[model samples]
Target: MFQEKNRHLPCFAHTLDLTASDNENMKPLIEKVKKTITYFKQSVNAADELRRVQPEDKTLKLKQSLPTRWNSVFYMLERFLMLNKYVASIILSDSKAPEIMTASELEEIKEFIQILKPIESVSKELSGEKYIYHIK
Candidate 1:
């Protein structure tokens, strides 16, 4: 409504720019995740566990994985959960079985996940899996 009086349907495309500056006050968890995942990959058991505990995306839905090596981008705030889960499975056994996160890291991850919950979720159904609302 602000521009040209509805000339466009107003598709909202702006995401908060997280990387334009390294505001340490706001983004330390992202840095922590990158470090944790890097450490997790240093051993074989951890790597195998990451392969096993993926969210069970049977449909072969793909995602950009950890870089062949870590970099500044690996520490970006956007992909923290991918980093978090990868580490958790690797370091923790599958019985009780999720790996533990440090208290502060867990808190930050929860906050980010909550903020992102509205975007989309993958679901499975008789028609096969796709992103959809929980109809039940």
Candidate 2:
């Protein structure tokens, strides 16, 4: 549809983003993470339970990824991995916790994070004000 109106659209980046999001290997894990985040955020008692499981040193709350922002997923997963143990405890302790990820799923998330790290860095670089090419 977009091509039908104006074919000049530079959709390479958008294509990449879509590929990453819809990849067969990642779809399930991403959905699970999204569901988990949503469940906690929607319920006050669940959020409180998650906080209780975390150690005193970590005070950050779980964050959900914005549907429109690709990097937000990385940020969300990064924090989620950091609080993995606490999250697991919350799942075990609360009967209402969203579907728990398996050990393999946790490992896969870590791998996905690593895959996205360089892309995230590139995204930051592209958004910076510094000149891409200083014609000296």
Best by TM-score: 2
TM-score of each: 0.40, 0.78
Scanning candidate 2 in windows of ten residues, the lowest lDDT window is 9-18
Q: List the pairs of residues colliding in candidate 1.
A: none
Query: What does candidate 1's lDDT look like per residue over 54-131, in tens digits?
Result: 666631211232433122232344454545556554556544233366767677666655553433221112224344
Error of 2 at 135 (Å): 12
Residue by residue across 78-110, what tens digits does model 2's lDDT show? 888987787777777778788788999999999
User: Model 2 reaches what TM-score against the true structure?
Assistant: 0.78
Off by over 4 Å in 1: 1-21, 55-79, 82-86, 93-100, 112-136
Query: Each candidate: what lDDT?
Result: 0.44, 0.76
Q: Candidate 2 local accuracy as lDDT?
A: 0.76
